[model samples]
Target: MDAPIRKHNATDEERFWAKVDKSGDCWTWTAAKTNGYGVFRIKPRNMVAHKVSYIWAHGPVPKGYEVDHMCFNRSCVNPAHLRLLTHQENGQNRTGANTNSKSGVRGVYWAQGQWIARACIGPKTILVGRFDDLGEAERAITEWRIEHMPVSLRDRRRRVSGPLADA
Candidate 1:
């Protein structure tokens, strides 16, 4: 679906910033939120706050690209931390392992006495490899991310810890 055309008048800009909690690097949205991301009602449509902020500062986000929050904060409307990325790239930049993950590492799971590494791109989930060691599986997933994801999307700074710390 196409994004709503924003009316960037002085009054609209004032109304937009009124809901922002500009206390830190992340200019957090204090308005209504869905799934932790801010939601703003712009007449006929309810639009995302960050998307509105991006349009206010820059322009309409390019077609086929999503606005990714580099700081990983959904409530943030800071344009400096925002970038245009494909859906796959946006998913690759996701923070933390899934809540249901038993392995503690993202894309690594234990099954049938082996650690299986997998990577998801768009709708397709590709099996990277299977290994007896969790470290090997983690490494395989990391390699896949490095190859398929952009440098900005890769979660390289987060050191793997917990049960898989050594791994």
Candidate 2:
């Protein structure tokens, strides 16, 4: 006869850690995932692993704030790399431009020999400005982000340098 599937009565913490692959920087979850993010069952409902980690480390996520992966790894369940952010803030923190984008930078594109910078807030798209140089376009986008987006949404790794460093 085939062996029966054994079910161990593990605690939430134990169950949570048991599925984590601690070998990597991300502490990647080895359990079921949806859209690259880890999913866990908590009796009546399914919960996201990173959210569970956040709740375990801190308290429940604040109202209107969703858990965001600071490392940008969807499968990461490390509490240290998680933060609660508003939807708009989370969108602002997104990395990389669309694959089809000719210009490498997000929100800045080359048109008619000039680099045009633009930004979207909700449904409205605002034209930041047009510049002759790529660096200037980048600076314009950066400045617009600083002025409009929250500080938490800004790229933490980006060091302040170049012409807009003082600004």
Candidate 3:
């Protein structure tokens, strides 16, 4: 998971760099994109541009580890904004709350007419507490998240008092 990174090859790097538009902070890929991620066709297969960028900056990606964009930008190829994470670790940065959640917060839910604050780390659900007020529930979950979740996995643009993100 902590493997070092280095550019794979010069020819591949040259071809990959040609398609990227480094206009601003988040270097964007100007070529074919599948689901907003850049795709490059090599002899063997296609590689995601951000993954290529990660490889160019770091090294080969470890198995089962995903390249996550901390800035919430799918087209960004900036290596500094990218990180390698497990599926569960990456899930913590999700913008949308659960679809069935009434409180519209990641770990806060409404059940039996009361607000419930809870969070899941790995396979276990940690029940923060129950609250009558929604704000209190949000605060409880926020506190739990701040105390428990790793700092790099936390969502910076989390909904404070609005609908669950762009679900």
User: What TM-score quantifies how close candidate 3 is to the native fold?
Assistant: 0.78
Q: Please report, as a residue range, the 10-residue window in candidate 2 with the lowest summed lDDT.
A: 151-160
Runs in model 3 with CA error above 4 Å?
Answer: 1-10, 151-167
Colliding pairs, model 2: none
> Order the candidates by TM-score, highest first — what do you get?
1, 2, 3
lDDT, candidate 2, 9-35, per-residue tens: 868788888889988788899989999
Q: After superposition, how far is residue 125 of candidate 3 from its true place, in Å?
A: 0.8
Ranking by lDDT: 2, 1, 3
lDDT of each: 0.81, 0.83, 0.80
The alpha-carbon deviation from the true structure for residue 13 of candidate 1, after best TM-score superposition, in angstroms, is: 0.9
- RMSD per prediction, one decimal? 6.7, 3.9, 8.2
- The residue-by-residue lDDT of candidate 1 on 1-167, one tens digit each, is 99645556747677788889999999999879999999988888999999999888889998889988888889999999888888767778877579999988889999999999988877899999999988778877876786777543445554343332345
Top TM-score: which candidate number?
1
